[model samples]
Target: MSVLIKSSLARKIVMALSGLFLVFFLGQHFIINITSVIAPETFNLWSHFMGYNPLVQYALQPVLIAGVIIHFVMGFVLEIQNNKARGLSYVKYKGGANASWVSRNMIISGAVILAFLGLHFYDFWLPEIAYKYIENNPEDATRYHAETVHKFEAIWRTVLYIISFALLALHLLHGFASSFQTMGINNKYSSAIKTFTKIYAIAIPLGFIFIAIYHHLNPITH
Candidate 1:
Protein backbone atom coordinates (compact mmCIF):
# COMPACT_ATOMS: atom_id res chain seq x y z
CA MET A 1 0.00 0.00 0.00
CA SER A 2 2.84 2.41 0.77
CA VAL A 3 4.59 1.56 -2.48
CA LEU A 4 1.36 1.98 -4.44
CA ILE A 5 0.74 5.38 -2.85
CA LYS A 6 4.19 6.63 -3.89
CA SER A 7 4.05 5.29 -7.44
CA SER A 8 3.75 7.69 -10.39
CA LEU A 9 0.70 5.89 -11.76
CA ALA A 10 -1.03 6.18 -8.40
CA ARG A 11 -0.30 9.90 -8.23
CA LYS A 12 -1.64 10.39 -11.74
CA ILE A 13 -4.83 8.57 -10.79
CA VAL A 14 -5.27 10.74 -7.74
CA MET A 15 -4.71 13.90 -9.81
CA ALA A 16 -7.17 12.80 -12.47
CA LEU A 17 -9.90 11.87 -10.01
CA SER A 18 -9.57 15.07 -7.99
CA GLY A 19 -9.37 17.15 -11.18
CA LEU A 20 -12.52 15.54 -12.57
CA PHE A 21 -14.35 16.33 -9.36
CA LEU A 22 -13.28 19.96 -9.55
CA VAL A 23 -14.52 20.09 -13.15
CA PHE A 24 -17.96 18.97 -12.03
CA PHE A 25 -17.99 21.66 -9.35
CA LEU A 26 -17.00 24.25 -11.97
CA GLY A 27 -19.85 23.19 -14.23
CA GLN A 28 -22.42 23.63 -11.47
CA HIS A 29 -20.92 26.95 -10.39
CA PHE A 30 -20.86 28.25 -13.96
CA ILE A 31 -24.52 27.37 -14.45
CA ILE A 32 -25.49 29.13 -11.24
CA ASN A 33 -23.47 32.23 -12.10
CA ILE A 34 -25.00 32.43 -15.58
CA THR A 35 -28.29 33.16 -13.88
CA SER A 36 -26.88 36.56 -13.03
CA VAL A 37 -26.91 37.41 -16.70
CA ILE A 38 -30.45 36.21 -17.37
CA ALA A 39 -32.06 37.39 -14.13
CA PRO A 40 -30.12 39.23 -11.47
CA GLU A 41 -32.88 38.99 -8.90
CA THR A 42 -33.18 35.29 -9.43
CA PHE A 43 -29.40 34.96 -9.18
CA ASN A 44 -29.34 36.90 -5.91
CA LEU A 45 -32.16 34.77 -4.54
CA TRP A 46 -30.32 31.61 -5.48
CA SER A 47 -27.09 32.90 -4.00
CA HIS A 48 -28.86 33.79 -0.80
CA PHE A 49 -30.46 30.37 -0.68
CA MET A 50 -27.08 28.69 -1.15
CA GLY A 51 -25.55 30.97 1.43
CA TYR A 52 -28.19 30.12 4.02
CA ASN A 53 -28.27 26.38 3.39
CA PRO A 54 -26.40 25.03 6.39
CA LEU A 55 -26.76 21.40 5.38
CA VAL A 56 -25.44 22.03 1.90
CA GLN A 57 -22.63 24.18 3.28
CA TYR A 58 -21.69 21.64 5.91
CA ALA A 59 -21.41 18.90 3.31
CA LEU A 60 -19.83 20.75 0.40
CA GLN A 61 -17.52 23.31 2.01
CA PRO A 62 -15.07 20.79 3.44
CA VAL A 63 -15.20 18.70 0.27
CA LEU A 64 -14.37 21.75 -1.82
CA ILE A 65 -11.44 22.68 0.35
CA ALA A 66 -10.11 19.14 0.31
CA GLY A 67 -10.58 18.78 -3.43
CA VAL A 68 -8.61 21.97 -4.05
CA ILE A 69 -5.73 21.03 -1.78
CA ILE A 70 -5.48 17.48 -3.08
CA HIS A 71 -5.61 18.52 -6.72
CA PHE A 72 -2.97 21.21 -6.31
CA VAL A 73 -0.63 19.12 -4.21
CA MET A 74 -0.89 16.07 -6.44
CA GLY A 75 -0.15 18.17 -9.52
CA PHE A 76 2.96 19.69 -7.95
CA VAL A 77 4.16 16.30 -6.76
CA LEU A 78 3.73 14.74 -10.21
CA GLU A 79 5.54 17.62 -11.87
CA ILE A 80 8.42 17.42 -9.43
CA GLN A 81 8.71 13.68 -9.88
CA ASN A 82 8.74 14.05 -13.65
CA ASN A 83 11.41 16.72 -13.44
CA LYS A 84 13.63 14.61 -11.21
CA ALA A 85 13.27 11.58 -13.47
CA ARG A 86 14.14 13.62 -16.55
CA GLY A 87 17.03 15.48 -14.83
CA LEU A 88 17.94 19.16 -15.31
CA SER A 89 20.16 18.47 -18.35
CA TYR A 90 17.42 16.54 -20.17
CA VAL A 91 15.57 18.27 -22.99
CA LYS A 92 11.99 19.30 -22.28
CA TYR A 93 9.90 16.59 -23.88
CA LYS A 94 7.06 17.52 -26.20
CA GLY A 95 3.63 16.53 -24.89
CA GLY A 96 2.17 16.66 -28.42
CA ALA A 97 3.90 13.33 -28.85
CA ASN A 98 1.35 12.06 -26.29
CA ALA A 99 -0.89 14.88 -25.01
CA SER A 100 -2.28 18.31 -25.85
CA TRP A 101 -0.76 21.74 -25.13
CA VAL A 102 -3.16 22.19 -22.25
CA SER A 103 -1.97 18.95 -20.73
CA ARG A 104 1.62 20.05 -20.92
CA ASN A 105 0.89 23.38 -19.22
CA MET A 106 -1.58 22.11 -16.68
CA ILE A 107 0.51 23.39 -13.78
CA ILE A 108 0.89 26.87 -15.23
CA SER A 109 -2.77 27.21 -16.15
CA GLY A 110 -3.83 25.79 -12.80
CA ALA A 111 -1.65 28.29 -10.98
CA VAL A 112 -3.26 31.17 -12.86
CA ILE A 113 -6.70 29.78 -12.14
CA LEU A 114 -5.80 29.42 -8.47
CA ALA A 115 -4.77 33.07 -8.31
CA PHE A 116 -8.09 34.03 -9.84
CA LEU A 117 -9.85 31.87 -7.30
CA GLY A 118 -8.19 33.81 -4.48
CA LEU A 119 -9.36 37.09 -5.95
CA HIS A 120 -12.82 35.65 -6.51
CA PHE A 121 -13.05 34.41 -2.93
CA TYR A 122 -11.90 37.74 -1.60
CA ASP A 123 -14.34 39.69 -3.76
CA PHE A 124 -17.35 37.43 -3.36
CA TRP A 125 -17.11 34.57 -0.91
CA LEU A 126 -15.29 36.41 1.86
CA PRO A 127 -17.84 39.16 1.93
CA GLU A 128 -20.81 36.84 1.61
CA ILE A 129 -19.73 34.50 4.40
CA ALA A 130 -17.25 36.33 6.61
CA TYR A 131 -18.75 39.77 6.66
CA LYS A 132 -22.42 39.05 6.10
CA TYR A 133 -22.76 35.90 8.16
CA ILE A 134 -19.96 35.96 10.70
CA GLU A 135 -19.08 39.60 11.28
CA ASN A 136 -22.69 40.76 11.06
CA ASN A 137 -21.95 43.81 8.98
CA PRO A 138 -25.08 44.69 7.03
CA GLU A 139 -23.47 47.68 5.37
CA ASP A 140 -20.39 45.72 4.28
CA ALA A 141 -22.65 42.92 3.11
CA THR A 142 -24.61 45.24 0.84
CA ARG A 143 -21.37 46.83 -0.30
CA TYR A 144 -20.03 43.42 -1.21
CA HIS A 145 -22.96 42.67 -3.51
CA ALA A 146 -22.68 46.12 -5.02
CA GLU A 147 -18.95 45.59 -5.49
CA THR A 148 -19.59 42.42 -7.46
CA VAL A 149 -22.09 44.27 -9.62
CA HIS A 150 -19.66 47.11 -10.16
CA LYS A 151 -16.77 44.78 -10.96
CA PHE A 152 -18.76 42.97 -13.63
CA GLU A 153 -19.83 46.29 -15.10
CA ALA A 154 -16.23 47.29 -15.78
CA ILE A 155 -14.72 46.35 -19.16
CA TRP A 156 -11.36 45.50 -17.57
CA ARG A 157 -12.91 43.02 -15.20
CA THR A 158 -14.87 41.49 -18.07
CA VAL A 159 -11.73 41.14 -20.13
CA LEU A 160 -9.89 39.57 -17.21
CA TYR A 161 -12.75 37.11 -16.71
CA ILE A 162 -12.76 36.21 -20.40
CA ILE A 163 -9.03 35.57 -20.35
CA SER A 164 -9.33 33.44 -17.23
CA PHE A 165 -12.22 31.51 -18.77
CA ALA A 166 -10.15 30.86 -21.89
CA LEU A 167 -7.38 29.42 -19.73
CA LEU A 168 -9.99 27.31 -17.94
CA ALA A 169 -11.21 26.02 -21.29
CA LEU A 170 -7.70 25.05 -22.26
CA HIS A 171 -7.21 23.35 -18.92
CA LEU A 172 -10.44 21.39 -19.34
CA LEU A 173 -9.70 20.37 -22.91
CA HIS A 174 -6.74 18.25 -21.87
CA GLY A 175 -8.00 17.41 -18.40
CA PHE A 176 -11.29 15.93 -19.61
CA ALA A 177 -9.71 13.49 -22.04
CA SER A 178 -6.77 12.68 -19.79
CA SER A 179 -8.98 11.92 -16.79
CA PHE A 180 -10.95 9.39 -18.84
CA GLN A 181 -7.75 7.76 -20.06
CA THR A 182 -6.33 7.71 -16.54
CA MET A 183 -9.47 5.95 -15.38
CA GLY A 184 -8.75 3.18 -17.93
CA ILE A 185 -11.36 4.16 -20.49
CA ASN A 186 -9.07 4.12 -23.52
CA ASN A 187 -10.04 1.87 -26.42
CA LYS A 188 -11.31 2.09 -30.01
CA TYR A 189 -14.16 4.19 -28.66
CA SER A 190 -11.69 6.55 -27.00
CA SER A 191 -11.76 8.83 -30.04
CA ALA A 192 -15.49 9.36 -29.76
CA ILE A 193 -15.28 9.89 -26.04
CA LYS A 194 -12.51 12.44 -26.50
CA THR A 195 -14.54 14.30 -29.10
CA PHE A 196 -17.56 14.57 -26.85
CA THR A 197 -15.45 15.66 -23.93
CA LYS A 198 -13.83 18.32 -26.11
CA ILE A 199 -17.22 19.76 -27.00
CA TYR A 200 -18.27 19.84 -23.37
CA ALA A 201 -14.95 21.38 -22.36
CA ILE A 202 -15.32 24.20 -24.85
CA ALA A 203 -19.05 24.76 -24.31
CA ILE A 204 -18.92 25.06 -20.52
CA PRO A 205 -16.08 27.58 -20.46
CA LEU A 206 -17.59 29.59 -23.31
CA GLY A 207 -20.87 29.65 -21.44
CA PHE A 208 -19.07 31.21 -18.50
CA ILE A 209 -17.38 33.78 -20.78
CA PHE A 210 -20.74 34.67 -22.30
CA ILE A 211 -22.26 35.29 -18.90
CA ALA A 212 -19.38 37.55 -17.95
CA ILE A 213 -19.80 39.58 -21.12
CA TYR A 214 -23.57 39.74 -20.74
CA HIS A 215 -23.37 41.00 -17.20
CA HIS A 216 -20.71 43.53 -18.11
CA LEU A 217 -22.81 44.98 -20.89
CA ASN A 218 -26.02 44.93 -18.89
CA PRO A 219 -25.25 45.47 -15.26
CA ILE A 220 -28.06 44.41 -12.97
CA THR A 221 -29.98 47.02 -11.04
CA HIS A 222 -30.29 46.23 -7.37
Candidate 2:
Protein backbone atom coordinates (compact mmCIF):
# COMPACT_ATOMS: atom_id res chain seq x y z
CA MET A 1 0.00 0.00 0.00
CA SER A 2 2.78 2.42 0.92
CA VAL A 3 4.80 1.33 -2.08
CA LEU A 4 1.84 1.83 -4.39
CA ILE A 5 1.30 5.33 -3.04
CA LYS A 6 4.89 6.19 -3.86
CA SER A 7 4.53 5.07 -7.45
CA SER A 8 3.40 7.98 -9.67
CA LEU A 9 1.96 5.59 -12.24
CA ALA A 10 -0.01 3.78 -9.57
CA ARG A 11 -1.30 7.06 -8.15
CA LYS A 12 -2.43 8.20 -11.60
CA ILE A 13 -4.20 4.90 -12.14
CA VAL A 14 -5.97 5.19 -8.82
CA MET A 15 -6.89 8.78 -9.60
CA ALA A 16 -8.22 7.72 -12.99
CA LEU A 17 -10.31 4.89 -11.56
CA SER A 18 -11.71 7.05 -8.79
CA GLY A 19 -12.50 9.80 -11.29
CA LEU A 20 -14.39 7.33 -13.50
CA PHE A 21 -16.35 6.14 -10.48
CA LEU A 22 -17.36 9.72 -9.63
CA VAL A 23 -18.38 10.36 -13.24
CA PHE A 24 -20.80 7.45 -13.14
CA PHE A 25 -22.12 8.61 -9.79
CA LEU A 26 -22.58 12.12 -11.13
CA GLY A 27 -24.56 10.79 -14.10
CA GLN A 28 -26.81 8.81 -11.78
CA HIS A 29 -27.33 11.83 -9.54
CA PHE A 30 -28.15 14.04 -12.56
CA ILE A 31 -30.72 11.54 -13.77
CA ILE A 32 -32.48 11.55 -10.43
CA ASN A 33 -32.33 15.33 -10.02
CA ILE A 34 -33.52 16.04 -13.56
CA THR A 35 -36.74 14.31 -12.68
CA SER A 36 -37.40 17.13 -10.21
CA VAL A 37 -37.91 19.32 -13.25
CA ILE A 38 -39.77 16.91 -15.51
CA ALA A 39 -41.61 14.82 -12.91
CA PRO A 40 -41.67 15.94 -9.30
CA GLU A 41 -43.41 12.86 -8.04
CA THR A 42 -40.84 10.62 -9.68
CA PHE A 43 -38.05 12.69 -8.18
CA ASN A 44 -39.63 12.47 -4.75
CA LEU A 45 -40.02 8.71 -5.06
CA TRP A 46 -36.37 8.25 -6.05
CA SER A 47 -35.06 10.67 -3.43
CA HIS A 48 -37.09 9.07 -0.66
CA PHE A 49 -35.92 5.62 -1.60
CA MET A 50 -32.29 6.68 -1.74
CA GLY A 51 -32.52 8.54 1.54
CA TYR A 52 -34.08 5.66 3.39
CA ASN A 53 -32.38 2.73 1.81
CA PRO A 54 -29.97 1.02 4.19
CA LEU A 55 -27.59 -0.06 1.47
CA VAL A 56 -27.29 3.46 0.15
CA GLN A 57 -27.07 5.24 3.50
CA TYR A 58 -24.88 2.71 5.25
CA ALA A 59 -22.70 1.32 2.47
CA LEU A 60 -22.64 3.20 -0.81
CA GLN A 61 -22.71 6.73 0.57
CA PRO A 62 -19.56 6.22 2.62
CA VAL A 63 -17.80 4.70 -0.35
CA LEU A 64 -18.78 7.65 -2.51
CA ILE A 65 -17.49 10.16 0.04
CA ALA A 66 -14.24 8.24 0.35
CA GLY A 67 -13.84 8.23 -3.41
CA VAL A 68 -14.22 12.02 -3.47
CA ILE A 69 -11.58 12.37 -0.78
CA ILE A 70 -9.16 10.00 -2.49
CA HIS A 71 -9.51 11.63 -5.88
CA PHE A 72 -8.89 15.13 -4.56
CA VAL A 73 -6.07 14.13 -2.26
CA MET A 74 -4.34 12.28 -5.07
CA GLY A 75 -4.83 15.26 -7.34
CA PHE A 76 -3.02 17.51 -4.90
CA VAL A 77 -0.27 14.98 -4.40
CA LEU A 78 0.36 14.64 -8.13
CA GLU A 79 0.30 18.39 -8.62
CA ILE A 80 2.89 18.93 -5.91
CA GLN A 81 5.08 16.19 -7.34
CA ASN A 82 4.81 17.63 -10.81
CA ASN A 83 5.77 21.11 -9.60
CA LYS A 84 8.86 19.75 -7.86
CA ALA A 85 9.86 17.86 -11.00
CA ARG A 86 9.32 20.87 -13.18
CA GLY A 87 11.39 23.08 -10.89
CA LEU A 88 14.29 20.66 -11.15
CA SER A 89 14.00 19.70 -14.83
CA TYR A 90 12.62 22.62 -16.84
CA VAL A 91 14.55 25.87 -16.61
CA LYS A 92 12.28 27.64 -19.08
CA TYR A 93 9.00 25.73 -18.97
CA LYS A 94 6.16 27.74 -20.51
CA GLY A 95 2.83 26.55 -19.14
CA GLY A 96 0.69 28.11 -21.92
CA ALA A 97 2.98 26.71 -24.56
CA ASN A 98 2.90 23.22 -23.05
CA ALA A 99 -0.66 22.68 -21.73
CA SER A 100 -4.16 24.01 -22.19
CA TRP A 101 -5.64 26.31 -19.53
CA VAL A 102 -7.99 23.71 -18.10
CA SER A 103 -5.23 21.09 -17.95
CA ARG A 104 -2.77 23.48 -16.39
CA ASN A 105 -5.02 24.70 -13.61
CA MET A 106 -7.02 21.64 -12.61
CA ILE A 107 -6.14 22.39 -9.00
CA ILE A 108 -7.82 25.80 -9.14
CA SER A 109 -10.99 24.38 -10.65
CA GLY A 110 -10.82 21.45 -8.24
CA ALA A 111 -10.55 23.81 -5.27
CA VAL A 112 -13.67 25.60 -6.42
CA ILE A 113 -15.47 22.29 -6.81
CA LEU A 114 -14.34 21.26 -3.34
CA ALA A 115 -15.64 24.49 -1.84
CA PHE A 116 -18.92 24.02 -3.70
CA LEU A 117 -19.18 20.51 -2.31
CA GLY A 118 -18.75 21.94 1.16
CA LEU A 119 -21.63 24.34 0.52
CA HIS A 120 -23.73 21.58 -0.96
CA PHE A 121 -23.22 19.26 1.99
CA TYR A 122 -24.00 22.09 4.34
CA ASP A 123 -27.23 22.87 2.48
CA PHE A 124 -28.51 19.33 2.14
CA TRP A 125 -26.54 16.62 3.88
CA LEU A 126 -26.17 18.28 7.27
CA PRO A 127 -29.83 19.20 7.37
CA GLU A 128 -30.63 15.63 6.50
CA ILE A 129 -28.44 14.25 9.24
CA ALA A 130 -30.01 16.64 11.74
CA TYR A 131 -33.50 15.83 10.60
CA LYS A 132 -33.12 12.10 10.64
CA TYR A 133 -30.50 11.30 13.27
CA ILE A 134 -30.23 14.24 15.63
CA GLU A 135 -33.83 15.35 15.62
CA ASN A 136 -35.13 11.84 15.09
CA ASN A 137 -37.90 13.04 12.89
CA PRO A 138 -40.17 10.48 11.35
CA GLU A 139 -39.63 9.75 7.67
CA ASP A 140 -41.90 11.80 5.44
CA ALA A 141 -41.57 10.43 1.94
CA THR A 142 -43.55 13.28 0.39
CA ARG A 143 -41.25 15.98 1.78
CA TYR A 144 -38.40 15.52 -0.64
CA HIS A 145 -39.75 17.55 -3.55
CA ALA A 146 -40.69 20.57 -1.48
CA GLU A 147 -37.42 20.54 0.38
CA THR A 148 -35.48 20.31 -2.87
CA VAL A 149 -37.35 23.24 -4.33
CA HIS A 150 -37.01 25.31 -1.20
CA LYS A 151 -33.25 24.94 -1.27
CA PHE A 152 -33.19 26.48 -4.71
CA GLU A 153 -35.50 29.38 -3.81
CA ALA A 154 -32.56 31.53 -2.78
CA ILE A 155 -31.36 33.41 -5.85
CA TRP A 156 -27.85 33.82 -4.48
CA ARG A 157 -27.53 30.11 -3.94
CA THR A 158 -29.01 29.41 -7.34
CA VAL A 159 -26.50 31.73 -9.03
CA LEU A 160 -23.68 30.22 -7.04
CA TYR A 161 -24.77 26.78 -8.11
CA ILE A 162 -24.79 27.83 -11.74
CA ILE A 163 -21.28 29.29 -11.47
CA SER A 164 -19.93 26.28 -9.64
CA PHE A 165 -21.42 23.99 -12.24
CA ALA A 166 -19.76 25.98 -14.98
CA LEU A 167 -16.44 25.45 -13.26
CA LEU A 168 -17.36 21.80 -12.90
CA ALA A 169 -17.85 21.66 -16.66
CA LEU A 170 -14.39 23.11 -17.15
CA HIS A 171 -12.92 20.56 -14.78
CA LEU A 172 -14.65 17.72 -16.57
CA LEU A 173 -13.57 18.97 -19.98
CA HIS A 174 -10.00 17.97 -19.18
CA GLY A 175 -10.63 15.31 -16.56
CA PHE A 176 -12.97 13.05 -18.54
CA ALA A 177 -10.61 12.46 -21.44
CA SER A 178 -7.47 12.45 -19.28
CA SER A 179 -8.85 9.75 -17.03
CA PHE A 180 -9.17 7.50 -20.07
CA GLN A 181 -5.66 8.41 -21.17
CA THR A 182 -4.21 7.73 -17.72
CA MET A 183 -5.74 4.29 -17.76
CA GLY A 184 -3.72 3.43 -20.89
CA ILE A 185 -6.61 3.83 -23.32
CA ASN A 186 -4.75 5.28 -26.30
CA ASN A 187 -6.12 3.42 -29.29
CA LYS A 188 -8.21 3.72 -32.43
CA TYR A 189 -11.28 4.66 -30.43
CA SER A 190 -9.51 7.24 -28.27
CA SER A 191 -10.50 10.11 -30.55
CA ALA A 192 -14.14 9.09 -30.45
CA ILE A 193 -13.98 8.65 -26.71
CA LYS A 194 -12.56 12.16 -26.28
CA THR A 195 -15.38 13.55 -28.41
CA PHE A 196 -17.99 11.76 -26.31
CA THR A 197 -16.35 12.98 -23.12
CA LYS A 198 -16.34 16.57 -24.37
CA ILE A 199 -20.07 16.35 -25.01
CA TYR A 200 -20.77 14.84 -21.60
CA ALA A 201 -18.55 17.38 -19.87
CA ILE A 202 -20.52 20.27 -21.32
CA ALA A 203 -23.95 18.66 -21.16
CA ILE A 204 -24.03 17.38 -17.58
CA PRO A 205 -23.00 20.67 -15.98
CA LEU A 206 -25.37 22.62 -18.22
CA GLY A 207 -28.15 20.28 -17.17
CA PHE A 208 -27.34 20.89 -13.52
CA ILE A 209 -27.25 24.65 -14.06
CA PHE A 210 -30.63 24.48 -15.77
CA ILE A 211 -32.10 22.53 -12.87
CA ALA A 212 -30.86 25.07 -10.34
CA ILE A 213 -32.17 28.02 -12.33
CA TYR A 214 -35.49 26.30 -13.02
CA HIS A 215 -36.15 25.58 -9.37
CA HIS A 216 -35.11 29.10 -8.44
CA LEU A 217 -37.49 30.68 -10.93
CA ASN A 218 -40.37 28.29 -10.23
CA PRO A 219 -40.31 28.27 -6.47
CA ILE A 220 -43.07 26.40 -4.71
CA THR A 221 -45.68 28.55 -3.01
CA HIS A 222 -48.14 27.61 -0.28
TM-score list, all predictions? 0.85, 0.93
Which stretches in model 2 have alpha-carbon errors above 4 Å? 1-6, 88-93, 96-98
Off by over 4 Å in 1: 1-6, 88-91, 94-96, 137-147, 187-189, 220-222
lDDT of 2 by residue, 140-191 (tens): 8899889999999888899889999999999999999999998889889999
lDDT agreement with native, every candidate: 0.77, 0.91
**Can you give the lDDT of residue 109 in candidate 1?**
84
- The residue-by-residue lDDT of candidate 1 on 16-64, one tens digit each, is 8999899889888877777676666667766766766777678887899
**Candidate with best TM-score:** 2
